[model samples]
Target: MSALSTFANRDELIVGAFAQDLSEVAERGRATLDEEVAATAHPYSITPSSLSHS
Candidate 1:
């Protein structure tokens, strides 16, 4: 959660770079970024419990 919360901010920065317009397409693309996130969730998930066990 900690690591993901951190990267979520970074992800905003990265996505912001490409989100420079107020067009519907841009908004739609931004609104639908969750699929990308969902696909990457497993690799990026870092729970406190996992670290404690390690």
Candidate 2:
């Protein structure tokens, strides 16, 4: 039981770390995309809201 508990704890920690990394990556990607869109001067002008459904 003790060994199983340790293994589970380790697994949870790894999963939590992975999730944090993924979240950071997603934030960076969104920021880069937003910067690109803002830099682009389109005729109609496409804002972030215009690309969203809601």
Candidate 3:
């Protein structure tokens, strides 16, 4: 018997909980990517000289 099965007679709850957690993480990741895309300038845009540290 699996650990979850031992704790809960039904395995569905374990699966459902995991799926919900994964969905939340994916949504946050997508939001972060969207913000990055919006902040970046066009092809000719240049970064400020002082900001370049490399």
Candidate 4:
């Protein structure tokens, strides 16, 4: 997650919403990583609006 700071593009940063716990987050990450444009950073604390309702 911290490694994302090396890039100049904050636009590259995306919040993958999940439960407060990391279980859902990890699952989401694995799924997305199979794509070409995968997430480069995982924020430590996502904003309230960024949280998943599902």
Runs in model 2 deviating more than 4 A are 43-54
C-alpha RMSD in Å of predicted model 1 compared with the true structure: 18.3
lDDT of 1 by residue, 10-54 (tens): 999878866764466777887679677766779658867778954
| Per-residue lDDT of 27 in model 2 | 100
The estimated TM-scores of all candidates read 0.32, 0.76, 0.57, 0.27
Prediction 3 TM-score vs. true: 0.57
Best by lDDT: 2
Candidate 3: C-alpha lDDT: 0.82
Model 1: lDDT of residue 37: 74
- lDDT of all the models against the reference? 0.76, 0.92, 0.82, 0.57
The positional error of residue 21 in candidate 1, measured at the CA in angstroms, is: 7.5
Off by over 4 Å in 3: 1-9, 43-54
lDDT of 2: 0.92
Per residue, candidate 4 scores C-alpha lDDT tens digits across 1-54 of 575675634544432222344777787887878653435545565757679696
Model 3 C-alpha lDDT per residue in residues 1-54, reported as the tens digit of each score? 988767785667788999999999999999999889768857666658647987
- Of the candidates numbered 3 and 4, which has the greater TM-score value? 3
Number of backbone-clashing residue pairs for each candidate, in the order shown: 0, 0, 0, 0
